[model samples]
Target: MFSNWNKWSIIVFIIALLIISPILTIFYSAFLGDTSLWPHLFSTVLPRYTLNTLILMIGVGSLSLIFGISTAWVVTRYDFPGKNIFEWALLLPAAVPAYVIAYTYTDLFEYAGPVQNSLRTIFNWEGAQDYWFPNIRSMGGAILVMSSVLYPYIYLMGRSSFLRMPISFYQTGSIYGKNIFLTVALPLSRPAIIAGLALVLMETISDFGTVDYFAIETLTLGVFNVWLGMNSLSGASQISSVLFIIVVILLTLETIGRKNQRYFEKSSGQNISSIIEAEGIRRLIYSFLCFIPILLGFIIPTSVLLNFVLKGFAVINFQEIFSAMFTSLYIAIISSILVISVSILMITVSYFRSNKFQKFLIFISSCGYAFPGTILAVGVIVFVGLLDNFFKFNFNYYTGGIIILLFSYTIRFLAVGNGAIKSGVTKINPNLINVSKIMGFSFIKILRKTIIPLIYTNIFVGVTLVFVDILKELPMTLLLRPFNFETLATYVYQYASDELLEECSLAALMIVIAGIGPVILLNSAIKKTGKIRKSEPLIY
Candidate 1:
């Protein structure tokens, strides 16, 4: 029946199936599970898991705001030494994965590591008991590591909002004796800040890596333990369902909060807000504050990696490393295109379809990003297993399949693509579509000739960002790869699993290198888009 519909309808259905499959699988398993186990879970480990997840979310959320918002404010509002470098450098941490940072931190701070050894030599300390250092494998360490890298999400969004604000707002705040930072900037940018924080929180909740490395007893870890340790995929699915519920609730709250508050520049005269120059001691302190996040996020870990590479201590497997890099790039590119295209289609349909049911369906489709990658991979496996079995019973297919994993990745990464494209589309005046309609253009024609051309750059940036994200993805790829596929992320995880990080440095660094292309492209696109928007003169 849908065959008569436009190509977009087919596209939407296909993408919807991809997004819904894993969720349906989880729901199926939840129904099948002997949830007599729930009582035991609640009595035993569930409370601790919930508590740890909450603490991690709160800690990382607050710290990332401090790191992300402060630097964004300073760079956008004030002119100081190194301000130019800090504007871009603050984003470098996004190129590094939280898990990779966790591994690097562990190596640098462990008992046999150089920091403790150097201190031992200097202080003539005897052993572990002679002097004390906080273990890097703790909750606090996970917070520090995650916040270091994840703050870039906030910084990106927060900086964009801060830069787009009209100078008149700040001027009015100054006249009213308001603290601009606390009263004007913060309140004005709350939507963007909350959106960024929502992304960070979803990432933190769905994170299996940092928590696993730190041995934090969070819900994600519990999901894994229940699935693999208890040999029960159903129990695992039930837990993942819980995680999904938490994410849905948070996203819902965000949507509700922003429902009544519209953030846009009403008087658009291409006004550029002039930066305030800091003088003397204040300037020095501001520079120091701006330096801290990037220092911890990029410099330290990168310096350690460089040391390993330069000391000739790490062997470079050029052939194997090159092969993994190629594989990673190919997969990232393919998945990125698939994800961004699907996201744009979904967002477009949601905006123009005018049917509430269709809009809600599109919204639900993007929600798959909330699942932890490994758990979602399992859902894909279970769902595809059922599909393959049915096909074999009727026609002839099997559990091991190819498109299954790609479908999973699209489901898992669509939210990032959706968020990016949605942000861009939101900036455009909705009346443009109405004007096109009044000019006798069909919806698809208007979308093709108008909306697509207008948001083409956002689509590109979204694809590139998703490409980089896929390049760094580990758990889903690990669980879902065909018999012998190896991406850089999986390659590094294997050796790093054995605590042989020196051996995996090439692959680990390759993940960063794979990301650099997309990161550069994204920054350039964002900068160019801002410039174009700024150059357009406003009408009275």
Candidate 2:
């Protein structure tokens, strides 16, 4: 197999290694140093961090599933008043970073914040001791804020999966007097739903902003505490190793969930799904339930930020923030392009030309997405620092040259690109590729003329997702960004950190605003994919 490997296989193999080098460096650093600190770490904070992390993952996962699946189910199955609005509005929270949600909700629900202030006004309560308002800085609060922002991952995947489900399956279930959700929809969409849930769980465990803000001692926060506070890179790498293990477990579960996929694969050209029209109270109930997530995720926080902007505009330097916005757009756009380019090459090569071992390496390369951004940043810094001894180059050359940040973004977001393209590629008939090869079409020509044109929608979606993710990314930008360089995420985080979130409201709003196009485009893409799938059935 090794002797027979072609140029495409070798090239993709190298790219995969380069992509995952940072992650490999993390493991290298963990075992490279003395093992003395392990005892103290385990004795003191490790168990607590592990417990908090597990608890947070479970809480956020459950809540996000409820919000994501329920809303997705309601929209896909039931026709209601706000179905159209909810279709896209439900995805809005994805634009808001978990930390920003943490900041905004605290402002709204805290003792002196508007919610409690109004409560005090209405009930004439005096101080914190007099009234027992829920602390928005607690573990529960962290789960709530993170769930609100992260559910969109599940929602997007679930909705797309639901939309892609064949109508005949539902009709057959109806004839058998089966529960559509349990008997049909759930089974067919389980793989996609699980993939989405895995992404959500990974996002939850890898989160820094929400956990840090709430002072929750998850593994991610523990990484920072050890790295920055205790000044132990080895200990930080150790904790990051734990996070990496968790990501592996989640990815394995995702893989397991994808098993028996052949059983659910329908070889039908009819891609239509039946939407039930709810009558009277059922309609109202469906509409109300669907709106709950949008309220928690998008409406409330956006309102708070908008209020902040209205009040603090006089103090804001629009010039500075706008400059940062352009910089963010530039970097995000370029980085997303690079990530998608690599994703197309790797996934196509893996799917078509590579052996199983090489394919596994390509797959593992995307594990970067599930690592905490700070942890990934550490890996990048370490990996680059090692190279700098010979290459005489560093990640932070200057603001004008932010190549390292672009590379980091590529590593972090390559999974999104891969997932998008994979979804498209899998839908393509294998016969098409076989016939192309039979006609003496080279791999490059087939990919360019056949795969790329066919999967342009997936490519577009991948680009949009990576672009938005880069814009909303915080920890990496905060760590790896050069001095005097600011993205919208860092801008919002800076002011939010200083308890002056109002000052950077416009930037925060822009981050949310930037995603609106993508969300709408996503909605359109799902609808469009459904139509496309009708014409192209699974070839058994």
List the global CA lDDT of all models: 0.79, 0.85
lDDT tens digits by residue: candidate 1, 319-425: 77778888787778888888887787788866765355555667777877776786687788788778767776342232243366668779888988998899778
Q: Which residue pairs overlap in candidate 2's backbone?
A: none
RMSD of each: 4.2, 3.4
> Candidate 2, residues 329-368: lDDT per residue as tens digits?
9999999999999999999888888888898898888877
Candidate 2 matches the true fold with a TM-score of 0.89
The C-alpha stretches of model 2 lying farther than 4 A from their native spots are: 3-8, 164-179, 182-184, 262-273, 351-353, 390-396, 399-401, 422-459, 529-540
